[model samples]
Target: MSAFGTLLWLEFRKQGTFAMGMLMVVAGWSLLLRQFFAWGAEPSIVALAVVASTLMLAGAVVTAYLLWLGLDFAREYRNGRWALLLGAPQPGWLHLSARLLFACGVLTLFAAGMWGTLAFWLGRVGLEWPLGLGLALWAYGLGGVALVVPVLFIGLLVAAYLPARADLLAFLVGLLGLGQLLEWSLRLFSAQFYRWLPPWGLPLPRLGEMAWEGFPGLPSEAFVLLVLLCVLLFSAMSRLWQEVEV
Candidate 1:
């Protein structure tokens, strides 16, 4: 197998297990909530739960990605594997691309599993399955870049700069989680304001809400702006990664 292929497998092997464990946890909580709470049967409530749970699951995946990348890179650097790889004929972008592909694949699985679970629950509730599923996945995909970019920036910084990989990963994860908590708190105060910010605060899809009604669907101008923002983020991340110390 190629080096990239081997790296991908190792990443999947580690992350797939975590994804399975997350699935079980989400399933158990969903089942329990359905059995105990009448509110869980309400479409809006259930949809919100689904969204929140999926977001949390996605966050867990991001956390895992950051942790693994940080640790793996740190180990490689410590053991001089990084130097070996650099000495090889392989391009720097190849290593970076392999890592990016691993991240995208893992994140896609997490997003798919969450949307699938949401579809099943919506089906049980007699809601329109396709719309619900489509909206769930589309919104998650659109919003994912915001979260991924920040996580990537922090992860690379920690991996390449920090002397203590474990401590840095722990601190970064805690900081990310804290940011989410603050976002949730702010949303409780005013969702409109939250929608104006990045990460959790950005406007994404609304399953039943119509775009013409000026809901979470981005306006034409804002959509263009968001695309630009994504481009800028990608460029910035690429530059940072290139400059990252071993």
Candidate 2:
């Protein structure tokens, strides 16, 4: 396999088991919730439970996974594996991208799973689950979660270069600044001119022949800015990786 491919395989092997375990936990909880809903429990209540449980359980699991990945960059002492990888010919972007891509793939599966699980129970009650809108909303929420990978990674890179006792403080500062970067980027890009850009225009799931109006689909402008931000963050991360002392 090529170098990037090797990194991805290793990452998959290292983290795949955890991913599968978390998936099972999510699926198992979903099944239990489904049973509860089947017991003539209120659909509204059951749906709320599904949302809460999935967010608390699966969300934490994924957060922990990404935090672990990001924290690796901040370690003061090199493990044998880190030692070997740093010695390899790969660029820092390759390593970071491998992890980012894997996490994104896992996150997408998770978003889909959450939507599916919710839809499964919702369908039993003759409710219309808006597939397009539901998935888009999930993407928006979970995409925020995914954005944290670069933030944490970037924060830790700054921390690694700071005095030992000040590392946490530095990371906190970086976290605040990097977060504003996202917020301001959104503010800057969400201008009226941006509205002129093409929108995703995905169809809303019909509610039993009820017509809906004025539903703005996903904004292509925001999507463009997000992609640009990701590229900028990734480039910063790769540069900091080179400059950061192990």
TM-score against truth, every candidate:
0.52, 0.72
- List the pairs of residues colliding in candidate 1: none
Model 1: worst 10 consecutive residues (lDDT sum):
210-219
Q: List, residue by residue over 1-246, the lDDT tens digit for candidate 2.
A: 898899899779877986787678668877787566766776555655665776677567767766765565445234545545545678878887897787777777877777787677667655567788667766665566456656646554654656466776777777788789878877777754476777698665443454358877677676677678777777887776665553
TM-score of 1: 0.52
**Cα lDDT of all candidates, in order?**
0.56, 0.68
Stretches of model 1 off by over 4 angstroms after superposition: 13-16, 23-33, 36-75, 78-80, 129-216, 219-246
Error of 2 at 157 (Å): 5.0
lDDT of 1 by residue, 1-246 (tens): 997787677667755676566567656655754542365456666766665765666566556655665566567767877546555555555566666666666556556665666666655644444554454454455455455555554555554555555756755774686477546645553645445555322334344652225335433333434455555555765665666555
